[model samples]
Target chain A: MLKAPALEARARAISKELRCLVCQNESIDESNADLAHDLRVLLRQRLMAGDTDQQAIDFIVKRYGDFVLLKPPVEPATYFLWFGPPAVLIVGAVGALLFVRRRNRVRAEPAPLSAQERQRIDVLLREPN
Target chain B: MRRILFIVPIVLFLAVVTYFFVAMRGGYNPSVVPSAMVGKPVPAFDLPGPPSPPNYAGPPVKLGFTNRDMLGRVVVVNFFASWCVPCRVEHPVLMGLGPSANVPVVGIAYKDKGQDAIGFLNEYGNPYVAIALDESGRTGIDFGVYGVPETYVVDKQGIIRLRHVGPLTAESVAREILPVVRALQVQP
Candidate 1:
């Protein structure tokens, strides 16, 4: 809603990063909720007033929790959120690698010859044909 | 040692399965994300009063609520509106609280027009001791209200002790809200 294109673009960028509290997954820029509109306007105002992006974001987050941020920062609260997936993947890969190595080790081991097998081999070697 | 390694994958698989079962049976609703404001001080906001309700015989509450007003008192702050069906459903339960609980029930009409907000109160006998307006939805956002009829219980020190999302059912009042409030009242 800013008259200046630069201001409008900045507002849009910030809005996209903020989640619409009323909607399930929509960002503020995309949402049509009354709260979202207020947020968009607020963001524009803050930018126009020369607040940095992070400052504006912090102001909003200070009021509404980190929930309003679309991508929450990696903090104590969101450590699991930020790292839970990679940790799972690493664990799974390690387990799989260990399993594969163990299986290959088993396959590489030579089976000891049974007495019957040894006798049959000797008999075959002794036969002319 | 070799045999144990062979059993390791099976053990790990079973462990994962058991975890899933335990977690699923834990019964935590995914939709109800814990409010960030829980245990923290209520957000600071001072809103202007909306127009007085029509056909209501009483004067309006205050200009608005700031975190200061909430200090040194136990308060039940309810976010509601005329358009919200859940708010209507929760009306009788809110009314039921005043006479029995002997507590102040402060209502903030969330994102509603002045006329409609007042009309809703008129339709459902006003249970709130101090009802105000959040016509711009700014105050509701500050409270982290995703929906209407969500109630919060604040302690004497202005710390948010509890938050009840959605409409308050009778079961919720007796089981959850009252116990917390009663405990907080006796609390220093």
Candidate 2:
């Protein structure tokens, strides 16, 4: 553990973003797997060696790739992974808006009655008396 | 136009379903992590050899190997441990690689006891040309090993060409491992 509380906190924050390769879902900070333990130690070693946070993370990413990160970096290859959900949401929202507008337009104006239909309504009203 | 629009959502839903179906049928395993070491030089590691068994008279194959040892020829490196069950299943296939493909197979005892690793080799038949003992698994981490029984194929230049993440089967040996080794061997 770092003697400095600030440095230890910084390390903790960085570790939470790192995925435990063995457990998959858990972060290295939360994982009990031996590999995760080793990674935690390696991360601390890098920090003590005067590596910046990005450098320490990059040291791992160089070996494990972007999958080791809980949040993937925005890049051309991950364009879809990052933007796909919001794009789908926007498309769905637009389609729903268009559907609602069309329905309201249809409801706002009734179709004009034919002459015969008008005469039938008049006859029914006359018989009601 | 309205009818076509009405079918849009259904079409999109089916497209999503078809994608999942195809992926499932293609045997997509979510657990398989792609190795980042491929196409890069093997990580630098100089590991010590596991302790030899008492009164054992096998060839001095227990001498630990290093990255420099990988130079000048094709080599197959396997990460394994006695505690790993799958390693047992893959042991026979590893034994066959040296004879069949004529590539020297190097072994790294990942996080296992020297005695236990020796016992495993004795029972399964030692397939390694040189065995490196990684008791702390620092070398395993350098190699990006998440688990035991991983394998790598290194070319003559000491560049890692391929990494197989799990235990090797006979079929995988023939299809994935042998072809890479063969191609690398013939390269000028």
Summed backbone clashes in each candidate are 0, 0
Q: Could you say which candidate leads in lDDT?
A: 2
Q: After superposition, how far is residue A115 of candidate 1 from its true place, in Å?
A: 12
Clash-forming residue pairs, model 1: none
Task: Give the clashing pairs for model 2.
Answer: none
Among the numbered candidates, top TM-score falls to: 2
**Worst ten in a row by lDDT for model 2 chain A:** A1-10
DockQ of each: 0.47, 0.75
TM-score of 2: 0.91
**Where in model 1 is the C-alpha error above 4 Å?**
A94-129, B1-27, B53-67
Cα shift from native, residue B98, model 2 (Å): 1.2
Worst 10 residues of 2 chain B by lDDT: B53-62
Q: What tens-digit string does per-residue lDDT give for candidate 2 at A4-80?
A: 88788878999999999999999999999989999998998898898999999999998988889999999999999
Chain A alone, TM-score for each of the models? Answer: 0.89, 0.87
